[model samples]
Every structure is written in structure tokens, then in C-alpha cells.
Target: MNKKLQFLVLGVVLILAILFFSVKWAFRPASKSVEKEKADFTMEASALAGEFEIDEQKANVMYLDKVIQVKGIIDNISDEKTVISVTLKDPESLSGVICSFDKSSLTITQLTPGEKITVKGICTGYLLDVVLSKCALVE
Candidate 1:
């Protein structure tokens, strides 16, 4: 009778231990160690803008949701406290690559208008400008 009681208690403790470890493992947060993928396409900021201007649908098919590396002179940068937004040069200065840097890559400072730079980001599509998000500076 004592052996039977000990067996029952051991079984219950084993089940509870399994449940606790499984719950802990399942609820663990995802890791942030994964690096961003390499750029899928590379082009000048003005050229990217021009493609969208020529055919919005075709450009969307070619570049939307794809990582792109763009090079050009700076046209503007948003004056907000965070400063995540940047615009590259265009002929009209009205249409260009508009990049929004991710929070993880927000170490930029001392950018001035007309400074040449290269940036990589995921293209999200175009409105007045070709919009890129999750951007990071490329040396």
C-alpha cells in the first residue's frame, strides 16, 4: 500500500514538472539576433523614383516589399525629434526616395542637404515619392 502511494505521487510530480517546463519554453520571447537580409536590388534614388513615375504598377511589381540600396544626394530630412525620415535628390526635387530608418539604426546625425549617401531599405511603394522603410545607412 505504501509503494502504491509513492508511485502515484511520483507520477503527479513528473506531470507537473513537464507542464512547467513546456509552458516556460512556449512563452519565451523571440530572439532579436537575426540580421537583416542583403539588399535584393540596387539603384540610384532618382532612378527608382523615375521608374515609379513611368509606371506605378510595373514598379510595384519590380520593387515592392524588396530590399533596395539607393544612392543620391540628400534632399530633405524630417525635423522631428526622432529624425527617422530622409529624402534623396530628384530633378524636380519633389519626387525621390523617401526613407524611414528603423529604430535599431537611428544613430545618424550631422546629415546636411546635398550630402551624398547610400541607404538600404525595404520598398513599401510610392505616393508622391518612392517610400522605403526599415532603412539603414550604407557606408
Candidate 2:
């Protein structure tokens, strides 16, 4: 009611408002990624193995024409970049349904052989080597 009491109440209200807004802004959700069309690249363990063992050029051509999403393990890795050239294979270790990626995309420091993972990429028909689309770590 008096000037002093009114000022005290106003200060408290302002502090509360500031605190509420700060906390709200701090906890807001981050922007979402653009949802893409559902395209699938899949193979049976046996079939993938068969494709790989046949031959290098023959194997590469089958998978290189379209977008491929392969599930396999990190077999061989390069030292220069945290990049792993991945393969989709079966029990036999023949089919080289290949995929690849850089290290920054990984939440882990390094990926090694036998660490099973899934990858999504566009299979760019070979140019001396298999070129892949946006290669993402699929776990």
C-alpha cells in the first residue's frame, strides 16, 4: 500500500518473472531434423555373403546403383581419418556390401573391427571405388 511496500512487491514479482523465463528458455527442445522418405536397403545374412564372395567389381555393381542401408560391423579402419570403410556380409565373410563414414559423426572416439553397426547411404555406382551417399551411423 505504501511506496516502500509497493516497491518491494514489484521487485519480487520482477525477479520471479525473470527466473521463470530463464528456466523455460534453457529447457526448450532443440530443432528437429527434416524427416526423409522411407527407403530401405536390406539383405539376408546368407544372400549378402553370397554377393560379396563372388568378385570385387561384380559385387560393387549390384549395390552401387541405389541408396543402400547396410547393417554390419566395422571391419577395417583407416588411421588418417576416423573413417571406417564398412561392409555388409554374412557368416562366410564374402559379400562386400560396403559403406563408409567420417569420425566426427560418431559419439565414440574410434570404431574397430567386429563392432557391429548399421549404416544408411546412397550407393553411388563405383568410380574406381564405391561412392556412398550421406553415410550415417545407424548403430
Candidate 3:
């Protein structure tokens, strides 16, 4: 083909190729298993909660979507049958670490409030409580 036509076709192809690869990478499934991923930070559950309460934006930058290992006393377990919500800190406290486990996880059934435990999960950020998902019992 003439140079102008060839150049136009090549540019369109390059743009299409870039878009295709970008979309593919963006939609790709995460390769790291939550259980196998290392914690980016480790701290007492109370401390983590406090950080979010004190400076949510800063805490979000540091912990949101990152794996964290937290140690605290179990405050409560939700009465829900199909989900596990493990609260860390005083049961009455609004600000606390709430680690959620999948219903299929057997470990949640074994947990009790007032027990000291260590858990690892991805920090999902704070609302009333600092929420963590995909939590696994560390101890």
C-alpha cells in the first residue's frame, strides 16, 4: 500500500493492541492467594482502628486493599448463620477492627468473644469499624 495508507493502518493497529492488553491486564484475576500473601503491616487491632479514626485518608493510603495482621481480643461474632463477623475490641465500641471470614471457613465456628487472637486479612477501610476481608486465624 502507499506510505500514508500503511501508516494509518499501523497507527490504528497499535492503538487497538494497547487497548486490548490494558483491558486484559485490568481484568486479570489476582494471582496471590489471600492466605498465602504476606501482611504489609502488623499491629494491635485497637491501634489499627485508632489510625483509621484519627486520619482516615492517611490510613487508607497505608492499609486499604493491603494485607494486615492484627492481634486483639474478640469482641463479638455476629449471630448470622451464613457469615462470620469477628469484632475486635470492646463489644460496645463503635470503632474497632471487624474481620470477616467466608462462611465456608471452619475457623470462624471455633472463635469466641473475649478470646485473644491474631488474624490476617485485607484491610477494606473504615466506616464505623475498620473492615477486613478474607481473614484467616493466625494463631
lDDT of 2 by residue, 1-139 (tens): 6999999999999999999999999998742211142335664433544554456468676765555655665555544355555554444554444555554454345456777666666666543334454566655
Q: In candidate 3, which residue pairs clash?
A: none
Reference-based lDDT, residue 25, model 3: 97
Q: How would you encode candidate 3's per-residue C-alpha lDDT over 1-139 as one tens digit per residue?
A: 6999999999999999999999999999754226778999999999999889899999999998999999999988885666588899855445999888867653556888889999899999899999998888888
On lDDT, the leading prediction is 3
Off by over 4 Å in 2: 1-37, 44-49, 52-65, 79-84, 87-91, 107-110, 126-131
Cα deviation of 70 in candidate 3 (Å)? Answer: 0.1
Decreasing lDDT order of the candidates: 3, 1, 2
Q: What is the lDDT of residue 62 in candidate 2?
A: 70
Give me the displacement of residue 87 in model 1, in angstroms: 0.3
Query: What TM-score does each of the candidates earn?
Result: 0.70, 0.47, 0.72
Error (Å) of candidate 2 at residue 35 is 9.1
Error of 2 at 29 (Å): 26
Please write out the lDDT profile of model 1 over residues 24-94, one tens digit for every residue: 99999843211266889989998999999899999999998898999998888885564478899765755
The order by descending TM-score is: 3, 1, 2
Q: Model 3 misses residue 38 by how many Å?
A: 0.7
